[model samples]
Target: MAMKHFTIQDAATMYGVKEWGYGFFGINSKGHLEVYPTRDENLSCDIHEVVTHLHKKGIRTPVTLRFPQILATRVTELNEAFHKAMKEYDYEGDYQGVFPVKTNQIKEVVDHIVKAGYKYRYGLEAGSKAELMIALSMNLHAEALVTCNGYKDESFIRIALLALKAGRNVLITVEKMTELPLILKVAKELKVEPLLGLRMKLNAMGSGKWESSAGDHAKFGLNTQEILDTVDTLERRGLLDSVQELHYHIGSQITDIRKIKAAIKEATRVYAKLVKRGVPLKYLNVGGGLGVDYDGSRTTFHSSMNYTMEEYAADVVYTTKDICTQEQVPVPNLLSESGRAIVAYHQVLVVDVIGLIDTTHTKYRVELSGQEPQILKELAYTRDNISVKNFAEMYHDAITQKDELITLFNLGYLGLDDRAKGEILFWEVCRKLSRILSYKSLKYIPEEFQDLNKSLADKLIANFSLFQSMPDHWAIDQLFPVMPIHRLKEKPTLSATLCDITCDSDGKVEKFIDLKDVRDEIPLHEPKSGEPYYLAFFLVGAYQDTLAMRHNLFGSVNEAHVIVNEDEDFRIQQIVPAQTTDDVLKSVHYDPDELVEGPTRRRKISANSDANEALKTALTEQRKLHTYLEMN
Candidate 1:
């Protein structure tokens, strides 16, 4: 309400688009957000066009748009960053990267990453038997490597060995000492020597929420003594040549460069010592911790990364080379599992804001009659008298009088008409106080007044289940960039928090990404009636897809794979429809036909033939529809 001159530059800055876009997301001259797949403004596609195209094909909002070009570009950037770093550092070993399939096991996403990086000899990392199947099926280059991580059962080990015998470079990293004996036995039984690895528990700790992924008490990996004992056992068995990779993962979404440098140095020291001991280690697998700055603050915050891909690659290459040089050992071929950085920018979830819940009571006036209750009159006065000078005191007075009005109503002393008026007056007081303080504080608004914004702002009811789309936000408070995908040229005069269409109260997002701090409400344009106002949630490709829940029985959203053509135009490559209600019910072990049996029996017995026919059609359609709130 205070600022009249808002430019596209202001919108970009407000949303941190340029900071976190990584040259892939930006606003175009037409006031719509565009995807610059090639990092050139001339070669971009309007995201709104992608959504409209999908709409024309019978798909509605609450669809996940996948930019395969973005995924491909990220793969190239990561490998090229490491290559450039290795070149500058004069490192002897080659750089080969693997995308851990656990981040996003979607077929299209994985296929694109592999195809994009096939030239650079990129491969997939599997942590379980199912993912191992994905890796073996990948048309990976003959020289590309597939590294097996996580705890391995006999079945998991057998598949790795079979692949190795079939001429695929598969490295099985032993997380526990017991897994080593199984690997040795399985190799002996199959008569095919297994290329092995050791998941070392690093002495150094990474930074951010998952820092414990590498330290002494890490969930997996071998400790120092265990590593030595495994090496000794391999040496005694004459299998030293089979040990090919020494892998270590600090964590996922590492935020600090110092932690990465320290961890790499430690990992290389161990690799060099093993090489000196005649273990023939050739690959130093640095596990996936490359972070994507979802918030674009470039700080050490959990949601942000202080370092760039260039800096991360440089630190990794230089640190490894430096440590190897100190120990007089040749540098090992490098491999990284940076899954988050590779896939986070490749997907955007667009949900429609179907309705608005505004409680500001803009039409309410304090024209109370003389017969009104004393407390109601007091709240009306507070609403009328709030100002920049006396707003703080009037805010406190409004709170007191509003509470008394509620008490009077509960005690049967106040009528419904007067009670409703008092409720209107309380929210009006909040709105007036907020406007008065908006221009005064500039920076240091009191906490109470800052929270007043949420109380006065509208609650936009979006048509997607937060629990089904983004579980991390609810489970870990992770922030994803959320804003209107179109209408950037128009100044947003309304502010609101987003709520999904779930019955649970936790299925809402009040905290939003900001440059300076976490924002309580997002600046939004007023929604036009009968039109779907869409908001795109950015950087949700990593871990959100698989971690989503079926809370309230809401199924997955439709997925759109968007690829740019030769002239940098738009085209929908493929569409994956969401699970139908019947499908979801079957997943939960519910038989649709059985559930409809009683209704069908009742219809058959009834005399209203037309109504029964309508009921049958409705049941058929309802069973086939998606579980999300269908918007018109």
Candidate 2:
């Protein structure tokens, strides 16, 4: 039989590359995955070349590739989209975006965003004191605004006041009524007029997994009475001008466009009311909820958004404009803290497959002697009689016979050898049934055999730690696009689940994104004995890096930053190597130097030269080795 052919298009479609890739990632004619820094340019850089380059430089698998060009492009795209919308709608308000530092917080990622967004006068949003410190240290442009959010102590308030005094555009958003008094006291002590904003708890809830971030029962934000009291208190204290911004966060990863429209309309109404009350609300901060289509379904699914960036900008601008016009209030400056949408596409995690555990290796017939157990003979008979027409019935019979054999063995009526033979026969029957089911149409397959493929699929053991790299997948069931980096031109004949190197059983990625639903297995090529196969997880730049944990003492992996030059040639801008064993030990409060010294001291005290030499060699090896598996 002729080998089935698979093209790059097939790989792209199977992995939803066109839907989620945003034209930055695709398969090239060389049968290797490529990254396009600019979609309009004809130049492209092969990812395999980047991996090979890193390997030659002593970096191995389980590495993350960071493309700063993609981050810059996304920032430009977002600013341009809003600018175009404002122009088309003829809105007078200016659009300013703040990168939420909590999304990544990595020094390199934050530095790149600051550099990329300089042209747009982009700002930063800090949720905690540490984040605020990072934001304050950044060399943001003069016109950029730095918004301080989340719960704050006196120190946090003092820091914001200090930043305001430093000639920075700093806004402190009050989450509760009590926070206003603290901010006022801090402002008086510092002798600086603090810029204050209010986070209103809107009744319009968001959509998708993070819907709890908004609505009436949200964890943060004030109610209607609280808002009125806040304004009243500010007026009484004669600090009403301090309240310059009104902010509301519907949620994160909001999938429905209608929910956004509703939230914007309601927030606009509140803004109009405040404007009528003689409050100088100059900034309308629409907190981040912009969604990324991780699965590329383009529906109201949790992993996707139904609206485009253009539509989102238009809706937000037009809704605010229409409401402000009706209320006869000046349109406020627009601010969005969209961190996920800007950073999700810039990083890709690549892992290497170590080996595979095939479960369908018992397809051959199980030899039986005439003196075997009656139940074993019955199972063999069912396995032999399984045809395309009677595969389902034979499968049922085999299962029944196997169960009986197990019960007999437990009751001391069947030998261990007989039970083993019966188990083999039962699996052979399932293998034949799976083949027959594959020949039948999807709809015609029996419900009993629907999960046969998943049960029989191979388990591909990969050389990465799921808890250390992609924790959201295990914690919140977040789906990421996964696909093989090479071998796109060859058809994948094996259905497998990716199992990470972590010892915990929860380290396996079994649920994969599909067009209509989640799939149980990912299609992959059969593993070769002496070759390496790599797979990449896409859209992981947003939260994975910061959210990774040290479970099983598996520290962060190696990272490579790639810069695409004007001529489309890729350069290794930076290579952050993975954590060594000694590094991880130090993190957990283990003194590596003391550990080596104590053992060596004891060996020397005993006057054992061989023991001392062995300890020295062991210590040297431990300090140089990484925590992850070093594949041969």
Candidate 3:
């Protein structure tokens, strides 16, 4: 049979790159995975070449690359989407997109977002005190908005009122009834009439793991009756006009558009009713749930979304206009806190495979002596006679004889040598069975028999900390796109899964993204000896950065930022090195000086020059170098 022909398109299709890349990425003629970050075809470079550039600077694999161009493009796309929607529908309400910094708290990310969004009066939404400080510090131009959310103490409320006093376009969203009295007192003390947003708990719950946190009983928002009571309280306090926005959050990463439409309809109706009652609301803040298609299924899958950005914008704008037109109230300005969708695509984590664990590499002939037990003889017979025609019965018999071998060993009927020989023969037989069952003539494959591929898939040991780099995968089983960064024109002859260089058994990735469902293994090319096999984990800019933990003391990885320029030119603008051993120790409150001295004093080495020089060199390198495994 002729070898199956493979092309770059074939590799792209196998990895579903086009399905989820959305024009920011593609395959080049040289079989390299190139990134066209600004959607400009001419301004592109393969990721492998970028990594090679870094490699020349002594930066090893397991690095992160941030494309500011992609980030800017996404912001522009979002703002333009809303603009087109408003123009097409002739909607009266204005649009301003507020990026919730809780999605990604990196300073460079937020700063680039501000610069990119300056045209649209784009703003930042803060969910904590520190994030609020970042929002205020980053967007002090007064045209950019600063939304203060989450539960507030006196200090939090006081800070928001102070921003209002500073002539900032800041809105302090009231999440609970108790927050109203607190906000009023803070405003009274500061003598500043605060711009407020009332967060209403709507009846529309989305479909996902976050469904439990949405709807009327959500942890953050107020009920309908409570909203009315708060409105009445504001009326009594002679501050009804202070309520400038009505906010509602369905959930984060909502998969279904029907739920979004329902939530928008409910939120618009609430805004309309409040407007009729003379609340003077100017902004209807429909909170974030815009999802990224991590799996590219584009269905109601929890990891994917069923709507496009334009569709989401149109639904929000038109639905609000339709509701308010019927209620005879003026349309309010729309603000969406779609943080996940905005920041999820700009960062890519690239890790190099350090080693491969092939189970069949140790395969050999296991000769059986005549004095061996019947179970061992049966296992040897199964191994030498296995084929596709009778693999099922042969596999079954091998399993049976293996179980009996274990029983014989436990019962002292088999010696150590006999048990070892039986174990080796059983695995050899199973390997042959797996190899033959994948033939072209095999029509029907049993489920258990098919699972042999997963069991036998090569293990690619990667050189990055899973807990530190991609925490969402470990915490909630979120799937990111994983594929080889180069060699796309060649066929992937190996089925493999990833294993991070952590001691914990859970530090591995066995499930991969698939069109129909989850896959157990990923197709990958065989790693060449003495060559770095690089793989990238894409779409990880959202919550993974801040949510990462210091599992096994792997603090952070090296990061480089790329800025694409006109005429197909790009430059590495900035590089942030990984944390050093001294830095990691200091972060955990361990003094590096004390640690070094303690080990040296405990060792009590001779006062010789050679011994002292060796210890000093080792200690100096340990304190200065990074925590990851050194390649040089």
Candidate 4:
């Protein structure tokens, strides 16, 4: 028998992949992701080997693999697309993009963005003072614009002023009327004039799950009245020329292109008005709201978008230029804060399947003891007689028998021996019945067993911490593409929901992305004999790494950076190992030093011991040494 082979193309199709720009994952002649699992004539790296390598290195259970080249490619593509749009549209404006630090604050991720984006002079957008500090520290390009947003206090304004003093061109966006006064006071105290901007609350609403992020009643930004008031305040302070930018944002993951055009028109009109009122603004900061095609539908749905990156840039530039040109205002430098589009496709999370529980792989067998309970016999009969057509009926009958058996045992009507038989019999029947109803060919599943479907959903024990790898799934119900990375030649036989190694019940990803509701189970292939199976989670690069919390005491996953050079040999740049038991304990304020020393003392005192005691002491010392080595 030949072993079944699966390729990356198989996984891409299962993900409903559509070419948004370039291929993130595609099938090669040998299968698996384009870079990993390269083609070999007879023997090649399979998903099993890829997973086993990491597991052998002590990077098991959960890991996030980040490809720096993919991130660089995504950033390059976005910048090039917008520039191409500018040329195609013949718009007089230029593209100046900034990565929002709030999206993903991982040091390595931010460091790479700053380094790789040097040619494009890609800037950073900060939403808070702490984020502002990071942006200022990382932004080596003096020409790159560091735009500061969010509600500001004296300290926030002071930091922005300090950034300007350091010779970095920092734009401070006033979200409220009072922030203008704070900025004025801080700038004067610091003896440095700050470049100012205002976030306008546009009347045009955006489309998507976060539509309220930019409209009239949005959480942040200034209303029409406040916008006018800020202009007067700046003029009164003799800093009108310092107010060089106007900004607005509808929301993130904005699906509708029309809303973008409307937002541009509205913000442009405000920009023109600011110029007419003697406010010398020279830039327009269209805040972050760029959408990502999470579902790959590409139909203007909330989780998806119809417009391409080029189309988006052309729309913004032309709309702003057309309106400003008509109003006789010069086209300001075009700026956009698009964090999702720049970083979403750069990271992938790889997890391994440890085992699965299946009770229906065997034929019906009856085990009858002299003291066996009567209900156990009935359950055995239910399992033996069940058929696809009568599966539901048989399941109900078995449930009734199971209840009677439980009651009989409680009342001492049955013995322990009978109770054990009844328990096993009932579970086997339930499992088998569930298998029947959940068969793919079953035209319709009865409504009464909907909850039962979830209860009996195939339990695939994957080596991962869902909360640590994909926090958005647990925090905001954000869904990403998930599928097996191999075994295309063989068809899937199990409908499985993945469960992580975490002890918390909520650590499972039972609900997945679907058109109707969160999915119950995804199709999974059976592992070939003496072979292992693994799966990969895609599109996890944006905020997952930085935002992941230490839920259930699980630390960050082991991360590797793969760089594809000219020869196509992926050079593994850096491999940051995951936290050890001691590391996790220290993060929670526990002094692992004391806990670590406990073992050494215990080992020295085998002052009196049998072989078993000596063996236990040696094991304790080995465990402590392992923990120390991993942490270091």
TM-score of each: 0.97, 0.95, 0.96, 0.84
lDDT of each: 0.88, 0.89, 0.88, 0.74
- Model 2 misplaced stretches (Cα beyond 4 Å): 1-4, 360-365, 369-371, 411-417, 440-442, 566-568, 597-612
Window of ten residues with lowest summed lDDT in model 4: 36-45
What's the number of clashes in each of the models? 0, 0, 0, 4
Question: Model 3, range 1-632, lDDT digits (tens) per residue?
Answer: 99778999999999999888878889988988889888889888778988999999977768999998888999999999999999999998799989999999999999999999998999999988899889988854457789998999999988888988988888999999988899999899899998999999999998776877787679999999999999999999899989988999988899998999999998889888888888899899999998889888898888888989889999988888999889899999999999988888899999988888866544456887677888878898899998878888889998889899999899998899888888888878877887798788998898878678788788999999999999989889988999999999999988899999989889999989988888899999888988888999999999999998888888789999987766545689999998888888888999888776765677876668587667777987789877888763
How well does candidate 2 match the true structure in TM-score terms? Answer: 0.95
Instruction: List, residue by residue over 86-132, the lDDT tens digit for candidate 4.
Output: 78767776777889999988888888888878788889999898899
lDDT digits (tens) for residues 415-455 of candidate 2: 87777777778888887778878774545876777788898
Identify the superior model by TM-score, candidate 1 or candidate 3.
Answer: 1
Residues 342-396 of candidate 1 have per-residue lDDT tens digits of 9999899999988888667765666788789888889888888888778778888
Per-residue lDDT value at 549 in model 2 = 89
RMSD of each: 1.8, 2.3, 2.0, 4.8
Leading candidate by TM-score: 1
Clashing pairs for predicted structure model 3, backbone only: none
How well does candidate 4 score on lDDT at residue 247?
86
Native-to-model Cα distance after best TM-score fit, residue 286 in candidate 1, in Å: 1.2
Comparing 1 with 2 on TM-score, the higher-scoring candidate is 1
Question: Cα lDDT of model 4 overall?
Answer: 0.74
